[model samples]
Structure formats: structure tokens, C-alpha cells
Target: MPPLNYFVVESPDPVGKDAYERIAADVLQDLDLIKVIDRLHIYVDPKIPLFVAAGLLRHMPRAIRVSDFANVNPGEKEIVLDISEEAYLAPLLRILWARFGKENVDQPDRFTVVLPAGVIGQKEIEQLVVADPSETLYKDVIYALQYIAPEGFKVRRQYIREGKFYYVASEDTLPGDIVERVVAPLFEKMGVTL
Candidate 1:
């Protein structure tokens, strides 16, 4: 599928659409989230200090497993992880330590961890989850929206699911019909039912 199409669907100030587009482009590119999104509809009403960002992601990112990053060797009483890539090394070590404890988990080198002496089953190590990119992407999207939205609009609400997200921000307490006012019209225009 193609990358997400981002647009300023509605804004209080039509002239400001260009600026918002620029900001969105920069922020999305900076976070490496441009391609993951399939469509983006943003609405900003500075006069009311309201901003909404709604988008559908292309697909859910896959979970990172222990096998994805390291080679697992199951021995008689322990499993040794030969961490090939260092990118997930820290988190991998942290998870191992958390699961097996500081004493049970050992790191003799920068890229090695041993689950000394058969405390857990072998399959557990193979199926360990190192990280979930979808979770991280959700947080990144939330943080990016904070930057994209006007600063100081602290009241925020977000709805994120498998591969879709909706966010809203405002300075004051938000009204109930805000979604109708902000996202519904954009969705309708995009031919999206919800």
C-alpha cells in the first residue's frame, strides 16, 4: 500500500493550512512514521484552541521476538543468547534479568547472556518478547501529535486501535460534540464511515 496521505481537512484559518502541512511533514518524517500511515485528517481551530488528528495506519507492526535479534542455544540446564545485533541488546538483557533475576541471568560479554542452570524451560526463552514496535509507534504518534498541535493545549484525548488512531487536544475542557465537529466531517469527506 502507498504511504499515508496527510491533509489539513479543516482549519479556522485557511491561510494557516500551509504552515500546518509543513509542520506535519517535518514531524512525520523525523519520526519515520510517514509510510506507516495510510491517511491523515487534521483539524485545527486555534480560536477555540482545539486540534484533532485522525489517521488510519497501513498495518499493525509486528512484535519483536528474542529469535529476531539473537540466536538461542538451549543446553541441558540453560539457554545462551548469542546476541548478533546490538540494537536490542539492552532491552533484551533487561527482560532476561527481569524474568530470571540478576543472579540467574549472566552476561560475560557485551553480546552474551546465559540463563544459568535450568531454571526455566527452553521454549520460554525462544518465545520471549523483546519489544512491540506497535506500542512504541503509538507513543511516538502521541508525542508527535503534541508537537503538531498548538503548544499549551494540554487537555488531550486519544483513541488508538489495531491500525487506526484519533487524537484531540484543547486548552480548556473539551466539549462532547468535539468529535462530531472535528473528525466526523473529515471522515465523511474521506469516504470513511468511522
Candidate 2:
């Protein structure tokens, strides 16, 4: 088996740790974000009606271009692409349609796309950005955290730094010092369990 990632859930009940870990891992994997997270710390106090999740994310994903996942060739009247990876396919299609107009971009198969000549040059196609994963990742993380956090603790505050992210939620209004009081302590303890 592969080494386990740094994941912790601090609650009065340690019995639920395994369940939380499984859920967290599944979600992160589906989002293609499991490896980017260096550590995750979760704390919930039912009595206090609070939930906190603080994690350290590695450098975000860089902008992905069509050339990074597909082979492109400019023909006399069209540009053809043979894609080997489908991870960014959806975004690539959207970008192509937007730049070349829907009528000019054609997908004859799952692994191929054709573009009319003059729609975009070979060099331009090579550098055309399909997606910026980090931008959507931020929103994905926030959405995932909402599910991880306890239900009914709807009021929330979130913080995102260069390589870090923290979330706090509670039933009642949180004070300004919430991060200093809660997330800061958990972040301090990350990368090593106490």
C-alpha cells in the first residue's frame, strides 16, 4: 500500500477518525487534489457547534496548454489534434470553440479535434491555455470543506494564503479572532500530530 497522507480529525470521538479519513481521501482524490495537500487538520466540537479545517496546500497547478496533453498539426486547411490525455479535454474543447467559433471547431471522436485554418495558427494553438486549475481548485476546496464540516454550522470564514488554506464555521457569529484562536493553533500543529 502507498504511504498514508497527513490527515487528522480532532474530536472527542476518535472512533470516527477512520471514517473521516476515508471520506476526505475519496473526495480529494476525485478532485485531483489529494497529492497537493501537504497536511489536513480538522476539529469539531459539538458542544460549541463549531467545525474547523486547516490544510497546507503545495504549490498550485500551473496553467495547462493543449500541447501539454495533445499532438497538434497544422494542415493546408485545418488543424488536427490527437489527444492522449483527457483530463483537460473539456476545457480544451471550450477554449477551442470560443476562439474559433463553434462551427469551426469539430470533434469527430473522443481523442481528436479539428479546426479550420486561420482559426488559430499552429504556434498559437500550442500555447493556447486550456485551463487554470488553481483558480477552480480554490472553489473546489471551499465546496469540499463545506461538506466535511459539520452540518448546521453554516456561518463560515475562510483564509487562503500562498500555500495554505483554513476554514472555520459555527452556528453562531464568529468573532474576528476566530482564526487566531482556532485555525492558527491547528496550522501550528500541522505536518506533525500532537
Candidate 3:
């Protein structure tokens, strides 16, 4: 696994800290988040019934479009999408099917899609979004953190923006000053002003 810029786990209990560190690392790896997360700090205090995670994310990939993986060609009576990459073929087909209807869209082969000419333009098809990495990113990050956090720490608070994220979970209601007192300090240690 590639190394994160910084990874820290803080807890008063040495044994628990070590155990949590391993658990956190395993979870991050399993969710394929290590590459995206640049810096991470986790604080767990079972006694205080708190689990806090703060991190910075690297630049996420832009949305994948038809033109990214396919070449649009105009045929006599139909528009031909000469797919260069098969990975996004399924999504591309689904979007085409939805927009043009199943009957109007034809996938004669794994590498091609045909649509009736005049129904949609080549420029429009090229811009159709096949995938957006950021759409599922926050969900994946939150899911990974939930698994790393102590089980039953149900009361939760989370914030993710631009390239920073923080998750707080506890059985008890979170304190009002938690961000200023806990999360902010963690980010500070990571050399992030927030």
C-alpha cells in the first residue's frame, strides 16, 4: 500500500491505540482510500465515548465522459460511437439507452454503439457523463471511517469539503466545542490551518 503523507492514531491507552491503528489501516486499504487520503489523524477515547477522524484528500479525478473513452463518428443514417475503452462501455450504453430509448440504441458489439442520426448530436454524446469520481468519494470515505470507528458509536457528525474531511462519532451527543477543541487541533498538527 502507498504511504499516506501523515498517519497518526492518538489515545491514552497504548494497547488500544495500537489495535485501532491496525484496524484503521486495514479498513482504509480495504476501501481503496489510502491513495486519496494525504494526511489522517484519529483520536479515540472509549471512556469519553468519542471517535474523531480528520484528513486531507488529494486531487480527485474529473468526470469521465463519452469522448474520454470513445470516438464519435457520424454515419449515413446512424451515429457510431467507436469505443476505445471497454471499461466504461456499460455505463455509456446505459446512458445512451436512457436518453435514446432501448429500441433506438444498438450495441452491435462491445466496442460500438449506434444511435439514429438527428436524434442527438455528436457533440452532446461526447459530453455525456459516464462517471464522476467525486460522486461516490464522500460516501466511501464516510463508510471507511464508520468501520474504523468503534462499533455502536452511532451519534455522528461529519463534514467534507474541497479537500478536507472530518468525522466524529459517539454514543452521546457531541459537545458544541468539539470542532474547535478537537478536530481543528488535529488539522493544525497536519499543518492545515482549518
Best by TM-score: 3
The Cα local distance difference test for each model comes to 0.81, 0.81, 0.90
Residue range 1-194, candidate 1, lDDT tens digits:
22566454567787787788788888988888887877888888888888888887878878888888888888777778899888888888788778778998888998988887577666777688888888888898888888888888899888777676789999999898877777677667666756
Pairs of residues at least 3 apart in sequence or in different chains that clash in candidate 3: none
lDDT minimum window of 10 residues, candidate 2:
1-10
Q: Measure candidate 1: CA RMSD.
A: 2.7
Structural similarity to truth (TM-score) of each candidate: 0.84, 0.81, 0.93
On residues 150-186, what C-alpha lDDT tens digit does candidate 2 reach at each position? 6788899987768789889999999888888887889
> Once superposed on the true structure, which residue ranges of model 2 sit more than 4 Å away at CA?
1-5, 13-32, 191-194
- In candidate 1, position 50 carries an lDDT of 83
Tens-digit lDDT string for candidate 3 (109-175): 8888889989988898889889987879989998999999988899999998999999999999999
Q: How displaced is residue 17 in candidate 1, in Å?
A: 0.8
Cα error, residue 159 of model 2, in Å, equals 2.2
